[model samples]
Target: MTEDNGGWIVFQRRFDGSTDFYRNWTAYTNGFGDIDAEFYLGNQIIFEITKDENVELRVDLVDKTGESGYAKYSYFSISGPEDFYRLYVNGYSGNAGDSLMYHSGQRFTTFDEDNDLLASNNCAEMYHGAWWYQSCHHSNLNGEYGNDDYGSGPNWYHWRGHYYALNSTRMMIRVRRY
Candidate 1:
């Protein structure tokens, strides 16, 4: 396993039906790197891909901890892979309910599960990013992860520091990217 100068971590499998990460025979990266691409799993995701194309890999986050820290916001944000970029959330997609999509305001709410995640304070909206912000579990006025003494939220109005702190409101965006 080796790290390229551009910070792209790649993993490949030498044989099928192999689960030994060290023996799977592959490459790796290390140190400071740009998180250009990643995914938003409702839990933690730490794995390497070795020689595969379009295979459905599933990760479950049933009451997981460590990397996820608190279990509020989105859940998890990863900085790897390629072609995955800035996330845009949409809350208005569901009806009056605690839909993971509606409350959390995420584009991809779930990952190969029976249902998506519910309202997340850690990874909620654009403020949380792929990883959680600094401070507390609740995003503050500065859009950081803290109380900031303002309130514990039900906070709406994603202004400068606040990305999606609306009043339990749903956000729907329709912008084309290239």
Candidate 2:
């Protein structure tokens, strides 16, 4: 839960294909995986923590070639289950490009729950992971580990294109001191 000597609480992490990110809604909601390894910090807890406070989101990415980049949002939050955990984010500033902004205002989707805007396909099921998807996503860190194929692996589309699977990804958040 600690990184770079900061109090950033990691919400999700992906690296080698050691853990399966392609899980059901309950698993994603209640949380799963080892904290020292790949995991999602659970949507319910995320909503509880950020609902009443100002939080900042940071997404770090390392591409297959070892190049790295990051994207930070000044404000971030999400609505609860009744609204499908709708995403809300703004004020982007970083080197990774604004991939997550495209997913802002979208709803979380899973193989068992299709809440994305895409009418024909369940983005989570098609992409092999769960996520806040809007007509799919520009960033899908929960996808199959190391797959690298289109819609099949963790990706920050703006940083390396959709087909280029990233080497690693970390999504972290912290309460804004101000």
User: Which candidate number has the best lDDT?
Assistant: 2
Worst 10 residues of 1 by lDDT: 61-70
Scored by TM-score, the top model is: 2
In model 2, the worst 10-residue window by lDDT is: 1-10
Candidate 1: list runs displaced more than 4 Å. 1-41, 44-131, 136-149, 156-165, 169-177
lDDT of each: 0.22, 0.89
Candidate 1 vs. true structure, TM-score: 0.19
- Judge candidate 2 against the unseen true structure and give its global Cα lDDT, from 0 to 1: 0.89
**Model 1 agreement with the true structure over 1-178: per-residue lDDT tens digits:** 1111122222111111112111100112221222222111122122122112111211111111212111112232223334121122232211122222222222221112111233344332333222222222232211222222242322222221222222211111111112
lDDT of 1 at 157: 23
How do the residues 50-150 of candidate 2 rate in per-residue lDDT, one tens digit apiece? 89999999888998788889998999999998888899999999998899989999989999999999999899989998999999889888998888689
